[model samples]
Target: MAPPRAEWLASSFACLLLYGFWGFLGKLALVRGLSSSQEAGLEKLGFFLTLPLILKPSATDPNAGPGLMERPKFALLAAYMSGVTAAAADFFYTRAMMKGDGGAVSAITASYPPVTMVLCATFMREKVTRNKLMGSFFTLLGAFFMARS
Candidate 1:
């Protein structure tokens, strides 16, 4: 079942705040001379630590659906690849932040939503509305200006 509107909004707000803190803390660590690899490794450790707090045993929890290995092969492949890609992206982002202005690097990376939109449209046959096109144009333009700094 889908979340209620309020619940969804609250979760979205929480994500926004957490992600904002994630970037700020990452930049702070990078500035303090943490190597990108170290930052990525430690960050991944923190990520793993969160899993036990949330994951419940399927045997005890009726809602705890199928185990990971029981999922479709394509889904598992996609999830695994996404983890790899996200880690690589985090590493590269931290490397960039080590030398570049955090704001500039973040702005450039923030432009990824446009790339995601385009990819979805191309690969998933998602509709491309005019509003999305205009938003993408403005988003890219803003990123370009920020990156020039």
Candidate 2:
């Protein structure tokens, strides 16, 4: 039998919360004791360990196609760029948090989704619904208020 929609939604949301905390905690750990290169090495080691567990089933499955080694160079390039961007963002975020008020920095960072949505709408010709506009306005306002406090 299929799971209920609400059950799926709740489970997804819970997973998101857990994953978000996981990233945050990892960043905190990296910020605590390691230089960027050390942090990257540690993360790569963790990935090597964890990824194989997830990939093992697919590796054994006859229906699955060729492994990631068969993928084009551009795919690896894109993944590398993603990692670079994430590392840069984390470095800046940690700097901001350490230098300024965490609450204010968090508020400003939380405002990013609205700014991203606006940019996407402008550049990608994506539809900007009224509700989205209102949410963006409120997010900015809340961030502004938080920063002012």
Candidate 3:
């Protein structure tokens, strides 16, 4: 791995902290009788909050990046994919937790870097080097070992 910049390091830690809380608090909520449907409904607030930032007029902010405004077609498709997958995954995850699934089991099952590597190789013409394959293998292997315990 390359040396981390301060900004990147800070953001990474922030994400880790938030994600840690997300899993912990999400499971806790399930334990406390929060329904999966309610969890799914609450998650939509995040998407709603992002609408202004996403749909803001480029004229309003001259320094805006080439986001959805630049490509409406693909943006719509991507947004659809993101929304559907996130909603479905959140529903199933919360449902699983409600049924007594452990956080470690969820982490192991949701780890998809290896699947991503294979997909990129097949669909995106990306290189699949020996090291990359080995790395992915070891990652899943480690997760498997952790899960088996």
Model 3 lDDT tens row, 31-77? 77778777656656765887888675656565566766675787579
Candidate 2 structure lDDT: 0.71
- Kindly report which residue stretches of model 3 are placed more than 4 angstroms away from their true locations once superposed: 1-13, 50-72
Against the reference, the lDDT scores of all candidates come to: 0.85, 0.71, 0.74
Mind sharing the TM-score for model 3?
A: 0.70
Superior candidate under TM-score, 2 versus 3: 3
Candidate 2 structure quality by residue, lDDT tens digits, 1-149:
56669956997888768655645655575558765456555756776799868666545565577667787888779789978977787666665654556567767765776877977898889899887889999999998998896
- On lDDT, who's better, 1 or 3? 1
Kindly report which residue stretches of model 2 are placed more than 4 angstroms away from their true locations once superposed. Answer: 1-12, 19-79
Candidate 2, residue 96: Cα displacement in angstroms equals 1.1
Residue pairs in collision within model 1: none
- Candidate 1 lDDT tens digits, 1-149: 55569946998889878877888898898778888888878888999999998675756565568777888999889889999999889878888988898878888877787889988999999999888999999989998898895
In terms of TM-score, which candidate is strongest?
Answer: 1
